[model samples]
Target: FVNGKSLTSTSGSTASQSTFFAPRSKTPNRQAIALISDHGDPAAEIGKEEAGGQNVYVRQVGEALSKLGWQVDMFTRKAKADDPTIVQHNPHCRTIRLSAGPEEFVPRDRLFEYMPQFVEEFHKYQAKHHYPLIHTNYWMSAWVGLEVQKTHNVQLINTYHSLGAVKYQAVPHRPAIAETRLAVEKAILENAHCTVATSPQEADMLRSLVSDLGHIEVIPCGTDISRFYAIPKVDARLQLGLKPTDEVIVYVGRFDPRKGIETLVRAAQLIKRNTVDASNLRLVIVGGSDPTKPDGQERQRIEQLVGELGLAEHTTFAGRVGHDRLPLYYTAADVCVIPSHYEPFGLVAIEAMACGTPVVASDVGGLKFSVVPEETGLLVPPQDETAFAAAIERILSDELWARKLRKRASERVQQNFSWTGVAAQLSDLYRRMLAQSIMGDMILPSQSAISVSLNPDALPNPSR
Candidate 1:
């Protein structure tokens, strides 16, 4: 049984018996970083039909790392038919898109067949311009990262943003993707040089589910505090076509059932009936999916829920809002609500706090780490209708207390999650892996040359 090893699924128990990861001394660090993800930036411009948190995380990390003097190149699959091959994000950060299989959009569940091609393409690019090691995001990219490791003998850091077994158990019926996901995730934990988790909850998860074979660094994600600074309450209301008199609660992310938008709808219903004070309360849902499209089934489900709740007038669906405009929504809202059933790390909470907006988030996953209960924000039991309504009402009724919470929330994020600080930590990880003791079996006893044959079938070195 796969149960005996250090690895377990998201729904599986964290093993009591685990191996500890010993990081070889902090070293010099790598000059260039190869960031890998199946979907997310710098390859795709977000705020489209199917982009969300993962995209935001990768792009910000890349841009932030670049600013700290490391050349960051994000490598990802070209998942769309007309997507560009390369997108230059900043002077130090760039994304190079390459062929994985069919040059078309395929649900990630079926992309396993094309990964060999992905590994080949990565090496081909590496041969052209030397990159020392790689940092892969998500389980799919982790699979490719492991395969490439055999040939490149390069350092790897795997970030399992979300786990499948945990998600599947929550669904009424498990999707076909669930069973296979368990396998790929295990392979990653057992082999990768390290697994970077954004929160301690996720790091604890790695120790319990996967082999504690390597280091699991808990690096919390940061926000653009400068952009989200407290806006004049009156000015913010005008910017979003809102009113000083109206009480608004906002949610931001792609439409997905796992996000528990339906729960928020239900909680909103309860709040409308129960709260005498927030009678003019409005809930706004923002994302990239169009409720009218066939693939946007989740968005349609959410709209249907809104209609069923008879909340047609109390709620506004703002379709998709880009990065440039995200701060406006945060500033205008009375509070930001993150009601995900589970999150590897809650980026939304940090972003909202940076705007000096207090949050009402589900007490699950990284949300617990991002928000402090009754301090910066209130954390309610996930999926509990009454708890959500009460928390919402409490924040709205107590303006003085809410303002104080917002001030502390902004300060906490600035102290811990600045992008520059995160980049330095990552840089240290890269350098430590370069030493002979840390690079695994790559360093031989005597003078040696290591040559990597960029996989078996790939269009090697576009320049070559």
Candidate 2:
């Protein structure tokens, strides 16, 4: 069953095999579409370096779209030699890893040079299995989509997972490829059929920093409600071996400086020093990292800071928690903290909230939209250790208020951030775009033919 609904055969045949395992011919007619995530492999393990929200977003969207009768083909660059070329998530959805530069992991900043080869590989695939509509993720994939559109009649839709214009503002230094990235991001916005912004703040950023000419839509990143939901605190704590009195604060994401891990660490220091009976306070940092990689180095720095701040005894680095086990951590926590310098959308915040845990996130980007300040959770200024400490302390100090926040948080997510709901919105948008393309084609024979058909009434309401 998908989202509490079962699939039934119209013929009412009592077949030996389940309908789920039926051949492609027996399946319903499905629209073929491509989702290109050049650097974010949809099938990659989460919490790893460069494998965070974008990876989860693509994979979840693909599977959810498949349930709505879309044959989803997710494309990504092959970063590892031993990894499979294709990973089938379901009968209708699969991830296609294409070879570009080398069969080794390369940082996103350096991956731009390899996009030409990625585009060529995409062309070869398009020749064999044509996709009339393609949605591209990130600036690199946007470039590929634009290039493919030059040769094919494919309708292009782009999602800027992280815009360089917004990201570069937070960093101390710019990368060598910053100019190229900025240019590509702007070009995609002005050229693609539409650009999807995960938050209204992101859409505003595109208008102010990127370009105002693009058709922008606000569709949020979603979480699997089936996977993440309220679990009894006692049960979750018992499963994770946590003390009943412990005031647990959990941070789940990549170990990057931009993610503001240091701020959370410092906030823990403040919580310990200022609060009475804070001896039972515990900080659980959950994410994957390699010692040699950038994120690993950041982890090392954070660990050293935790030691210097005398938080070593109170802190636990729970390496990498898988999705199956992640909900337990969220449910067990007293409060979840997301101290990112910037987030287009904070997937961790909603995931934790869905598990009936209050969140203390930075008041930046999409966190503003997801976490309803006093109603669901608290939002503090980004990188402000004092503010983060105060916010987290509020949740831990007042059990009744926290409980209220928990219930409202879960309800908010169920009403707005379910993967099934998100996919339905995207399906509507895709159908409308396809219809507009067909309409444009049908009118091409007229003397007063319009090059494009963009009826405002046909567009999905951003307010939804």
Candidate 3:
């Protein structure tokens, strides 16, 4: 339990928890920050049925901020009973999992009801640490930050990983909580000290659809360029037990209706029909959920579509590839497809590009900004099977053109989407907000400002 003590993972795996302290100055300055993501656990494994870009964003940003001298404490719900209550990533960074409801996995759409308990537990933790700065991820966490501001006067900086207004337009059936989400999103944008948009397009969406009252900053999401750097396609394929001569096309993401997996499957069918040697081409769908879950049902739907299109023989559902091994799949692929109906920031596109793979993504939202047409990758209309097929075929058919796109794709990611660079931009914003606080102009609740306590007895020392 995360009552007031740091607990290690049940398995006692060294990789699960980082050391308490790293070598640094005798007495380094401690600038603390609390990152709230109610459902997206920063310490959770990537590529899970529920885990996606938000989890990666939170975890990477926290680690990078720690490097820039901010003591980062990420707050997320404890999903499993046996999971570690706290996961330390560095001397200055840790993930604090607090219980809000049942200590089991819950879908995001139904998690809103547990938020009141989450807010209470979060305040309990804050009563001891008294953090004055909070950077929240997603709308659910944004609501928690809004509540905290009512009583704590903490500076609120938010990143709406997905906007409710924009998202509802993409799906056929909106969740019952759509109204609540839309209201909270607007409130967060208008009231937060600053809202950090992961892409310029997302910032535009905030102004046009959400609200225009609060300050907005465009800070892009990032990838580990070092881990995803160009590796030889032959070597990568060999490591992954893939054929060296096969024309591999990869799709890596959650099995959700909004992801547009059906579009990719249809494109693959078109490619097979239009190509000279269909037997040489392979389509790898790299993620799925347990057969009983909603996402799993979506996976079954995709599998059925693949079968109906006669792609069962040519396609493979590789399931969820581990983070360490994802780069291999990306590097081995001739082209990576991201056929999402909408995306605020397509983290997968940058990641594939970082691995020197050309991307063929839907020309929508942030994908338009991330994928430069005929340069790093090609963008086609969302759900346009013919256009997607053509874009992928162009890259796979011409080796020289594919090589050129691959080189520029890696260069583009290196220049713009490195985690360190993203963190620096965020660190600057955090400092600006703190400066405003010093001037007594920081945003606060309508009621009154609540001062953070300096009492050492409030909470256990986070450094421990």
Candidate 4:
């Protein structure tokens, strides 16, 4: 609406305005890099429980790549009724929603069948706006990644944020996903040009489970240090209407069983029984989930368990908060927790660090990689509520130690996990990859290749 075009939400403060599509960066190659996801953009005002992290990762990466002179196009399956088919996030990047089974809300767990439709629609769109390759996310998108590679000679790169094998182990006797899913993941890992790993542990797991020499690149995920910058704790709490004496514990993630929300609530119960200042401690659970959806089943189960334990008065469920507001929550929190049974890379830990807040995350998955024990944050066994409670109590009761931990956490993130730093590294990788992709084409028998080397006037089309 600012320039006769709908403004797709981005991390900007409106510096200037133009009448038409102004390229966000100098386009290095006219070739577009298509990013396919199952649930689409989380910043679009409607999102699911698992959609939040995926959305941030895709959009931030897309924006960073685009800014570094790549034509980035993020693609996702349509899961809404009135949602636009394409959302231009920045001039060089967009979110294209393709029709799959139905143009309505359908959970990601059930979207595997509509993948062929996703490929066809993607190809149809590509034929209209030609792009060379694709970068797809999650196992669901891996199905589409395989199909897209089969349809065209395009390269396929994938990121498996969470694995079915690990997730199935977290839930109690849950129904297994499609038998073809694990097979497809293996096939995709084998066939795809490259796959990205978020942590060393995940890369090790992949090498162990899939192949020893799997062509996976370890690119750990990042956080926006600028938005999550350190703020005075007293001012942060004041800004968020938190009491000066209140102790706040924050958990931000999906309501999935793997996230272990029940474990956090149970820990709160234990804290109440052991501590005198428990009345001042508050637990806030924030996520991007529709409380009415069937996906809320797990969330409701957590709530039920909380009420049954008589800890209902101490907990607040603030659902589907906007991305812009996340920093406030982290800054105002006394201690941020990630009780997930598994995490490929825990963004919350870095986010908490960026906010100068101490974290007490589970000692599993990426949490091990992110949290420095007794330094930045504490880690306990995944479902050990008693240990979790003890850690929280220790942080709140000792102000000096917690402040030191917070200072150390801030310094650690400033050194390692900034979006600007990650973007620069990723941009270099993309340029190298693109250069390699082009260099190989020059050695081919194509008529354009020889002509370009022979005559400067015949240097091939700049825009592919």
Candidate 5:
């Protein structure tokens, strides 16, 4: 049984896990909501070519919402044949992968053709178990949500993890589906009940670049404080097989050219040439890639560049560290660098800060919002090797100042960017949207209704 409904068919060749078996009487009493991330699978391993901040955001938000008495179902396209169709993260949250295209990995640019099948599967699921509200992630999923809204009595909320208008300005070559993505992105922003922008910068971009007609809210991305909190630097370094006295700088993200890994590599070279005692300097790049894929090919190029610069001895390609082990790399580092040309929300910056590590990130998009210059960490111009080297060297040279930055960085994340706090804000937004849908008005409910409606032991009674 799943969500108070009987499983009608389960004869697939792939192994199925009966993990969503909450008894009807004891199940969550709050309203069920669907989180649609079409290309980014919330359950997929982080650091994979396609998996990054957007994937982390959807998965973390779903699990966090489930803790607040929400029945969260995250839907994504089934990418691999051997992968399970359903993965239960908790009693209240699960990932449901639907069959789309050939059940193989397809780059997001080419995944639009398979969206009709995804929408059909979603409709089938909705027929059995209704989702009153659906929050869509990325432009592809936003299109699916818009299509679903046409046939179903559902409220749609969208978050464009990356905007095409903003992204296209950065890259030299544009994908063939760029026009379609832009159109869908615009329509979703204008037509959806609300569009959630992860940063104020992103919200502003939506109005100027996408559409000026949508209700936008700024809800920054959050990190798991419990998992990412400060581990002793000595212990973290020892575990990672790094010397305690080494001046370590870490880069954690995908291997995409737009991520500016090459810039970071060049910045490292500059540091080595300038620093008087560069022998103890270490650079650790953490992310996963498929050798046959674009990210893998990019990694090969970076490795070749590292060799050309004669920095291989100082650099360790710690490729694709798992989420469970990522905190160690962050904690062990003197400073973490996010050199992305654009980031809708820089999750790595906050994660590192949560581990009491300072950040030196590009001053663009969400990085500008997450990293407070000279307070938590410094922000340098995007793709500027000299600026990055100077900022990194400043932090590494001044241990006293770096310690102060680390303390404040951890404090800032705990006080402001905790997942539990972010979920509460999301819970309020969901309630307001649901209340509006019920009343057919712009007015929201009283404080009493919000408190009582979300109570775990009581069923949601909007009328009350």
Candidate 6:
């Protein structure tokens, strides 16, 4: 514990992991920015069922924003008894988990009832360590921002990690809370001080599906360029214990049906039939929860499909890989496939590109924005196994063309998708909003004539 605090778990038990906290005196100009991510825990390990792009987005953006002088505190729901109440990432950045309903995992669709308690706990935290501005992620936390705004002198900024309007279109059976989600998503888009869209496609979706009355900024998600870089494919494969003759195809992220892992598996079957030397072809599926958990059920279904296709010998389920080791997997792969039905901003596409690996992603939502048609990688229609297989074969067969794609892919990411770049864009947005409030020039929702200016190009225009 630092500075006499117990520094224990959310359940108030002694924690085994150590936390690093800065002395109170070290923080100057304590203008704090609170990031509320009710379901996405910033400190959780990546590739967990609930822990994917949103977790990485919150943690990376918080840490990077801290470097720019905002005292950043990321608030998330305590999903486990042993999870820490507070996790210090740096001198200026930390994650605080609050107990909402039960101090355990609740699927996001059923989490609305506990939001009032989340707001109450947030009020208590704000009372002790007040934050002038709050940035909320997802629909549930956006509602928390709205409730808090009624009583507190705080500005709310929201990032809808996944839009309900966009999601329902892809699935035949919508969740029980679909109507509620649609309503809340509309409310957040129209009322939040600012709504950050991770891609131009997301902004377009909001404009079309949700209300058009919102302050929208297109700030694409970023990756750790330092960690995921252009390493030689041979060296990467060697590190991962793969033979030089192997043709590797990787699918990383959670085991969700919408992620289209089944599509990838089917595509692998097509590749075997279409390509020569099919014996050396490999498909590495990386991510899942525990066997008894929700995502594990999806993984089991996928495994059954793999067995039925008779591709179990060629497919490898490298479950729940660590973030540090992800670069090796990306580098080792000849092609990285992200076959999500929809993505706000496909972080994995850029992460693979950062590693100088070609990507064959679904041509939907942010994947369209992230993956260039030919320069960086190919984009196949979602669920089209034949298209996916052909795209994969194109990269593997034409070595010269693949090399060109890999070089451009890495350059594309280096120029645009670094965490530092993403944070800078967010920092500019926060500063503008805060400055307006201090100067009494802030435009409240009640006033219809207010036009506040935001940096036109806060982040590189990935859309262009």
Better of 1 and 6 by TM-score: 6
Compared with the true structure, what per-residue lDDT tens digits does model 3 show for residues 43-154? 9877766799999999999999999888899999999999899999998999999898899999888888888888889988777666768999998898888888767657
Candidate 2, 42-158: lDDT as tens digits: 999999899999999999999999999889999999999999999999999999999999999999888988888898898887876667689999999998887787667676899
What does candidate 1's lDDT look like per residue over 217-268, in tens digits? 6777767666656777788788888888888899887677778788888888
Per-model lDDT: 0.73, 0.86, 0.84, 0.73, 0.85, 0.83
TM-score of 6: 0.89
RMSD of 4: 10.0
Q: Worst 10-residue stretch by lDDT in candidate 3?
A: 13-22
The all-Cα superposition gives candidate 3 an RMSD in Å to the true structure of 9.0
Question: Candidate 3 — which pairs collide?
Answer: 128-458, 128-459
Against the true structure, whose lDDT is highest? 2
Worst 10 residues of 1 by lDDT: 13-22
Q: Write the per-residue lDDT of candidate 5 for residues 103-148, one digit (tens) a residue.
A: 9999888888888889889988877667878999998898888777
TM-score of 1: 0.85
Q: What is the TM-score of each candidate against the true structure?
A: 0.85, 0.90, 0.89, 0.85, 0.90, 0.89
Tens digits of per-residue lDDT for model 4, 1-464? 12223333232212121111244356333446778777656345533555756787888888877776677888887777688877887888888888888887776667776777787788786665545557788877876776665445454678887777566555566554545566666666666666778888887877777654336777878888778877777787887777878889999877787778888898998888887657787888887666677558887888899889887878888786665887888888989999988888877789888889999999987788879999998999998998999999899889999999999999989988877777777665554443434345432233231122112232111121
lDDT of 6 by residue, 183-283 (tens): 77877777777889999999999999987677788898999998999878889889988888899999999998899999999999999887676899899
- Model 4 stretches with alpha carbons more than 4 Å out: 1-30, 171-176, 438-464
Error of 2 at 289 (Å): 0.3
Estimate the TM-score for candidate 3: 0.89
Give me the runs in candidate 1 sitting further than 4 Å from their true place.
1-30, 48-50, 277-279, 291-295, 436-464
